[model samples]
Target: MTTTPSLSRTDWTLILSLALLTFVLGTSEFVIVGILPDIADGLSISIATAGTLVSAFAITFAIGTPLTMSFTSHLPKRKLMLTLTAAFIVFNLFSSLAPTYGILLVLRMMTAVVTGVLISLAMLVASESVPTGKRGIAVSFIFGGFTMANVFGVPLGTFIGQRTGWETTFLLTTTLGVIAFFAVYRVVPSQLTSVKTSIADQLRLLTNPRILIAFFIPAFGFGATYVVYTYLVPILKGVLGVPVAWISPILFAYGFISIFSNMAAGKIASHNPIGRLRFVFLIQALVLAALYVTTSNVTLGLINIALMSFMAILLTTSTQIYLIDLAEKFNPDAKGLASSLMPVASNVGIGMGSALGGLVYANAPVMTLALVAGAVALVTALLTAVSHQLDQR
Candidate 1:
């Protein structure tokens, strides 16, 4: 058996460093929404088709994370993380330089898969080093990097992309990835941990009911968020009648509110995991539901966008902490699997959200997307409430 990694200043620095990587990766993953029209036009595709770029990436994350974790689980995690980040960095560079739309789509999928792995690995590292009480905060801190990505990275990238071109956003993403590579190299020491399990053994972790339920909320919750988010550009442009120039700023505003929501989630979850998360999920359902009526009025829509962004990520951070707690209590041996499962849940949500959003748009007008999203969120919250009761018992 490999010894567990002990906390060092090195771990602390790398934790923050990897968190920054997630910020850029996440921002790039979702930033296209604000500028989806430019991308669609540039590629000579319809806006609805251009939307696949979002869904495709989410699909990759849903399917790719566990396989990547299983294949690499036994290797030294530090080395694996660095290598995956480097691969991720290169893939983003490819996204920046992709000449044809086909290449860009492929590269985005590649980046998403590695991103899924990076997300899981970062959580595993956090769990390894931090004490139990502070572990949730630590994990939340790392995820906070992603939340702040909306606050800073995605909005800024959207603005830059809209001003120059969508290609520029990939450049910005590449720069962030390069900076992250070095940061992880310097700050995160190469501490290898052991896992002797075969791939089949790793799969067994998902068989546990608690783990399944633990993973379920985010899939449904974030899927709901993505249904609205994946088509935000279309909704803003088509329904709200926002002009092209204003879209970036609107997204910027949403990202800004998301930061505060992310922090508030971490702070509140520290006290009441079940109540706080459950409340956030319910509020998210309400806020998304309101978008149908509110999105008709530009002022109402943009204001509600801010409110929705704030509510969007609350479930993610809380669910992450909840998983860490559950992992420590029941499945210490499966830390890597548990850590990785969160993304699996969210990615599953992302796929469901994107697919459902796409399905709705195929038949109905854009406003229906909000209703679709709100309905999914309602289901997620209901299931989560039941799960929470089971969790309590």
Candidate 2:
């Protein structure tokens, strides 16, 4: 076994740069939800059809990321990180200039190809670059970028899109990406270690049942949130009767609460993460179920949404650290691949939940999304229990 060195100031810079990049990526990925109505209106598509953009991007991210990680596993981390961030910027630029819905959707799919992998790389870099004892907090800080994206990026993008045009939101994301690219280039070490594992070896991690189940825990656990989250805009307006002007501020509040969620997740991961996560999922289910009862009252509904937002990310850090540790035990050479699993699974859940929510929206009332998502959360709890039992054995 190797010992991790204490973190230097340079190491902190490296971790924070990676965190900034993830923030930009997370912003671009999630800002669409905040601006969905604007995009729908701009393209003359039904909001339901527009919602498919989130599902499409997530599904592509879910399916494309691990393959990308496998292929790129041998490359130097710094160069790969820089190259991916550049591609992300270009894609977002083109997405802003896209002529029609088809073109925009295609741009989003192209962007998705790199988004998940970029996030995985960020985690891989932060985990490797920091001391072993601090890996949980370090990785959580990387995820904190996503929560901050919720706090600042998404709300700001939504406000911009609402005021100017939906295309402008992509431009905002592009600018952030540029800043992240330079930060990464300046701070991330040019010579960080890269995995030499073959694609076949990396893919072998999937063959292990423990690895597979571990991956799905994030998928189902986080998927429950996307089910309702994908439609939160409409729910806020149509169900809760929130004014159009209040949307961004409400989203700001949700993201603000989520920052604490990410912090708590890091701490939880430092202990018995798998055992603790089962109860976390149980609480998530109850909160999601509460959305059904609370939707009729605006104050109660917003509070419930805040609770849902908080629970949405509680599993992330725990599952992330868990996956990397499990991979080290089972497939030591495939840390990059292991790093991809949680993000991939979370996006899978996002795609599955968003697609499911779209179907429900088409046939049922939008408010029904709460109940459907609650059921998914319940299953997530069961899966967590099973995983915890397996951990014991």
Q: Which candidate is the best by lDDT?
A: 2
Residue 6 miss distance in model 2 (angstroms): 7.0
Number of colliding residue pairs in each model: 1, 0
Which parts of model 1 have CA positions greater than 4 angstroms off?
A: 1-12, 31-53, 94-106, 155-171, 231-245, 292-302, 328-330, 361-372
Q: List the residue pairs that clash in candidate 1.
A: 219-349
What TM-score should be assigned to candidate 2? 0.88
Where does candidate 1 have its weakest 10-residue lDDT segment? 2-11
Error at 290, model 2, angstroms: 2.8
lDDT (tens digit, per residue) of candidate 1 on 1-393: 755344456556766886887887778777877678888877788999888898788778878887877777788888887898889778877777777779988998888888888888887777666655555556767887877786787778888988998888888888888888887777665654758677776777778787777788888888889898988989889888999999867866777777777677666656667666777778888899899999878889888888888888777666777775676677655667777777788777777787799899888887888887888888887877877888778
In model 2, what lDDT does residue 342 have? 94
Whole-model lDDT, candidate 1?
A: 0.78
Structural similarity to truth (TM-score) of each candidate: 0.82, 0.88
Per-residue lDDT tens digits for candidate 2, residues 1-393, read 966466788878877888898899989998998889989888899999898898789889888998999899999988998899999999999998987889999989989988988999888888777787778788888999988887888878988999999999999999999999999889887767887878999999989999988988999987799889989999999899999999977877887998999999988887788999999988999999889899999989988999998898989988998899899999988888899999998878877888798998889978788889989988988888988998888
Please report how far candidate 1 places residue 33 from its true position, in Å.
5.4
